[model samples]
Target chain A: MPLPSDIEKSFAASLLDKDGRVPSDLTSYSSPVPQSRFNIYRNNVHVALIDMMAAKFPIVLKLVGEEFFRGAARVYIRANPPTSAMTINYGKGFPGFLENFEHVQDVPYLADVARLEWLRMEAYNAADRKSLGGEDLAAIDHDRLIETSFELHPSLRLLQSEYPVYSIWQANIDGVALSSVDLNSGGEDVLIIRPRLEVLVIKLASGHCDFVRALGSGIALGEANERAFESHEGFDLQLAISGLIGCGAFTGFSK
Target chain B: MTNLSSWLDKPIPARAGVGLKPEHFAEILDTEPDIGWFEVHAENYMGDGGPPHHFLSLIRERYPLSIHGVGLSIGGEGALDAEHLKRLKTVVDRYSPGLFSEHLAWSTHGDIFYSDLLPLPYNEATLETVVAHIDQVQDVVGRQMLLENPATYVTFKSSDMAEIDFLREIVARTGCGLLLDVNNVYVAGTNHDYSPQAYLDAFPFEHVGEIHLAGHAEARDDAGARVLIDAHDRALVDDVWALYERVISSGVSVPTLIEWDNDVPSWARLFSEAQKADRILKGAQTEDAVAV
Candidate 1:
């Protein structure tokens, strides 16, 4: 006897295909046209899930034309089937899938573009935080700053990639003219943080990439600054600090 | 009893409502639309305390809320998912939705959840399974849940029951009300080559406590056949609205919600759809009162 889980998995898989065969173990009845009935239910379920994916990853779909995206999506669905009952976050690992997908490897930046899109979704759904301003950061004394850890804003997301992800996203967005983007251009380190109500993806100063990343990973100012100097010599402390502060990336400082 | 009754029954005002998508959370809180209520997927709020709770609490203060579940899988052959039921119970108690509804389909078996609402054959075996599942859900949630009809693409050769008969039987067996999704009726009727109006005529309107209207998509089959895919929330297609008019004219004046789950539009656009429903319901009410 097939376990219920296996039966359900097979049923879902059947929906994504034309066979529409329910797991043979599910039925003992000598019913003809079982496949036909299953086909109807299968189509509804398959299309529903596809529609869900399309809604969740619109930019990704737009970036890779619809026909290719849907074809790739059906494959992704079968491989990394949803784990959570809340299908809203079902395609969380899609970026990674696109990165390693053999067919999409030609578009080296496609995966990074997908990551950017995913971050956009994450920032959109992330908890709303009262983003602090320059006034809030000024209150922290320099003597205490070294010992203090900064809390990234609730919607703050760091997407560092070896490709020009922002430009790739920009080129595909609706109404934006399609242009030949040079893939060989040196990589960009993007800070995808919602400083206020709107989520913004600003390119980072090469030197401050390590600094913001360390701070985002819960490092104190003194330690993150040291890491920043080690990674990129002469990393500008004043520029990075002022930029982070101005963007409302730091919600609060921990003494 | 006061709390339970209050919990189970909140005044469902005849106004338009929007499916509470994550995209519009901040907007909904910032610019509170004159929406009658907000509906959410019960499964989405199944998580432990976080943003969903934070925003939902804020929205609940200003608008009546409804919990529309997509994963209960009420018509499956397997036993009702106990853990899923418990999670649902937690959300229901937390929000106390004015109306709680789930689709009349199944989506899981033990650890494997398909994450899609798959239909059941309308037969004796399926009927028994549906009744058992409904009883289980009601027992866990402490209220009668409404089961929305499924939009089907195919029929079973061995199925002895009609879709209407199957629903009427479930209503009788479990005492749960029906959530008449007119768009679903139209989609299924057209897909299966049946009259949408005929399905509505057979629907037990007296037992219906809610109505759903949403948009759909079209797909071509392998044999070059065009099939209607019920892509919820693109727009309120003309056929669905026409079906709604027919349903309300038949005197089923429940708290109707305009569900737009995918490609959700702006708050104004969503509320406008709700406004359309509100207008029709209002016209129906005035005509009824004048006649009486």
Candidate 2:
């Protein structure tokens, strides 16, 4: 006699695999009808999960269109069903899944766009914190500032992609009259942060990206600036620092 | 652990309420409608802080709240997720909702979570599992949790107990209240060829803490049988409203909720539905007073 858990596990297995048959011990109506009845549950699971994916990745769905996106979503869902009750975190692995997904391979930038969307979702839900202004940085002793490492906001997310993911995201979302984007125009370094209620997605220069990434990793201010200068010629430390402060990227700092 | 009375400082009034949606936050704050209370999906507020918390806090200050959960998976064959329970505890402690409820159906299996309320067979084995899970939840939350009836599509021949009897036994064992969803009764009754009224009559309304009324989608199964799907996307049909009237007139004035999860209409439209329920409840109260 299988416990109810055993039946439920088998039922879940059957839902994931279309070719799988309903468990024998689990009785519903007679043969074919039971299968049909069981299909309702199967359909509910697939449709509901797919709908969640669509909500989390509307841009991806728009990029790939409904039919193709749902097809890929079905495959991704079967491989990585949500482990948490939070549907907001459902597509943590979707970007990675898109990277290796053979079907959407032709559009190589698809995965990076998905990554940007996922980061946006995360930033939207991150903890609320007060952002530090340039005055707060100036208040610190100049000598101590060199030894200080700034703490980035809890909502901050940094991404470096070989494709123009930021433009693709903006183009799809803003519906700004789709202009041709050059794939060979190097990569994009993106900064995602929620200073307050609204999440902002900003494209960063390479040197600034290196500087922000270093600060995010807890590198000292002097050391991070060194890395930024090393990354790009004619790096403007003052401009990058002010730009970061304007975006509310740093919450506080400690020497 | 918090005392039950202290945990639920503001009891939900036995009147009509509506599910809180983000789109209506500004309107709700502006208009401040006469809704008796408000309900929110617990998972939506699980994040640390954001507009969800900001809006919910403002709403919480005014109306009594009910924290309805769709993700507890109380019917799963495995142990309840400790981390999920902790997060729920945090929400309950923060909001101190008057009522906390979850569906009897399972939404998770092992590590995978299904976003919908999946049904379970009415059998001794399943009954025992549900009882234990509810017991565990009550212990962790330190408050009684109401288990809402699920709108099932299929029935198992291996089951020995009726759905009503199964619920009765669980209530007897765990001492938890019932969150009677009348729409589920209608949906399941029509699908299974039973009388929705009979199910209502058999329900232990004495233990019902809250009630839910939602719209469902109607379709036909392969066997040419009428199937009612619990879609929660439209207005309440005449039949379900009639059923609600009967339940309210049955002398139980529970905190009723109008849920519209998909294709959500304007605040005015949703509030109109709540007003309709309020009228029915008031009518029942008048009748009760006359009899008294």
- Identify the runs in model 1 with alpha carbons over 4 angstroms from their true place: A1-10, A17-46, A171-182, B1-10, B15-63, B77-96, B109-115, B122-128, B139-143, B157-169, B172-175, B183-204, B213-251, B258-280, B287-292
Fraction of native Cα contacts reproduced by each candidate: 0.17, 0.68
Task: List where candidate 2 sits over 4 angstroms from the true fold.
Answer: A25-32
Q: What is the lDDT for B117 in model 2?
A: 81
lDDT tens digits by residue: candidate 1, B153-226: 55544466888999999989899989888888988887666899998988889888788888887764444445
Clashes of 1: 2
- Per-model DockQ against the true two-chain complex: 0.15, 0.62
Candidate 2 local lDDT, A1-255, one digit each (tens): 666767788887888886757665554332334666677778888998899889889999998899999999999999888888977778899999999999888999999999999999899989999999988888889878778999999999998999988888888878864466676777999999999988999998868888988898999889989989987987788888888899998898994
Compared with the true structure, what per-residue lDDT tens digits does model 1 show for residues A18-77? 466665533312232344445556655556667667777787788778888888887887
- The candidate maximizing TM-score is 2
Listed per model in order, the count of residue pairs whose N, CA or C atoms clash below 3 Å is: 2, 0
Clashing pairs in 1: B73-B105, B73-B106
Cα displacement (Å) at residue B209, model 2: 0.7
Structural similarity to truth (TM-score) of each candidate: 0.78, 0.96
Question: For model 2, what is the alpha-carbon lDDT of residue B250?
Answer: 81
Worst 10 residues of 1 chain A by lDDT: A25-34
**What range of 10 consecutive residues in model 2 chain B has the weakest lDDT sum?**
B1-10
Report every candidate's CA lDDT. Answer: 0.76, 0.88
